[model samples]
Target: MKVKGHCLCEKVEFSISVESKRFDACHCSMCLRWGGGPALTVEAENGVDFADEAFVKVYSSSQWAERGFCSHCGTHLFYRLKEGNFWNVPLGVLEDRNSFEFSTQIFVDHKLGNYDFANKTKMMTEEDVLKAFGAET
Candidate 1:
């Protein structure tokens, strides 16, 4: 499905191609520090189309992935893998939020004691995530 959304200030708008409404919450340390909580995201294939790309600032968060946000309002946008043209876009930023489900939780071992979700999701530990992506565990 194709979804459209904008940043907090609306200075940055985008349209991305996604597979389903089901999203995942990442509890990795990098994700927690980036958004002050779990990064709820939906997988988007290929890439995203930004209205004005200048407003989107990207940070190389890891060797294989990077994060993008609105430079103006600092709204967390997407976490993109450098290879395979894959993107994990924040669900909160998507315009049509209906019918979305919390499906998985990645890096479950890195989750802190401060918060958690009640829904029973398919939790994957750091090792599982790394192995699934063919990365070094």
Candidate 2:
């Protein structure tokens, strides 16, 4: 399915194709510190078309991943891998966030102990995630 979305100020608009409405909550430390909460993202590894590309800033958060945001509104947009052209867009920035269903929680070992979600999601610990990504453990 194709979905359209934009940043808070609407300065950065994009349309991406999604295979499913399943999204994941990343509970890694980097994710928590990035937005003060788990990053809820849906994979959109291909066909991401941006309208105002100039308004989007890409920050290399890690050796393997880069994070994109709207320079105008500071709205976190996407997490992209340097290799494989992999992308995980933040669900909150999508126009149809309500359609997505919770499917997984990555970095479960690092999730904040202060709160828990009511939804039952497949949990992946840090080691599991690292192994899956072939990232350093």
Candidate 3:
């Protein structure tokens, strides 16, 4: 499916072709610090095209992944794998929120006790995430 989205200030806009409607949540420390909570994201592994690219700033958050956001509004955009063009766009930015399914949660061990989801999701720990992404633990 092709989904359209934009940043808070509307300075950065994008259209992504996604293969699945399933979304995942990341509860790693960095993600928590970045968004003050788990990042709910949808796999946009097929392709993505951005407009007003100059307003977007990408931060290399880890050795294997980078996070993108709007420089003007500081709205979180997407997290992308460095090895490939694989991208995970934040669910909050998408125009339509009714179609996606919560399928997985990564860094599950790091998730805090204060909040929980009712959804039965596939949970992965840090080590599992590393292995699944071909990264060193």
lDDT of 3 by residue, 1-116 (tens): 78999989998889988877788999999999999999999888665689769998999998888999999999999898788778888999998767898999999999999999
- TM-scores, all candidates, are 0.94, 0.95, 0.92
Top model by lDDT, which number?
Answer: 2
How far out, in Å, is residue 64 in model 2?
1.1
List RMSD in Å for every model shown: 1.2, 1.2, 1.3
Return the top candidate by TM-score. 2
The residue-by-residue lDDT of candidate 1 on 61-127, one tens digit each, is 9988899999999998889988888888899999986668989999999999877899999999999
- Model 1: residues with Cα > 4 Å off, grouped in runs: none
lDDT, candidates in the order shown: 0.89, 0.90, 0.89
Segments of candidate 2 deviating more than 4 angstroms: none
Sort all candidates by lDDT, best to worst: 2, 1, 3
How many backbone clashes does every candidate have?
Answer: 0, 0, 0
Clashing pairs in 2: none
Tell me how far candidate 1 lies from the true structure as C-alpha RMSD in angstroms: 1.2
Best-to-worst order by TM-score is: 2, 1, 3
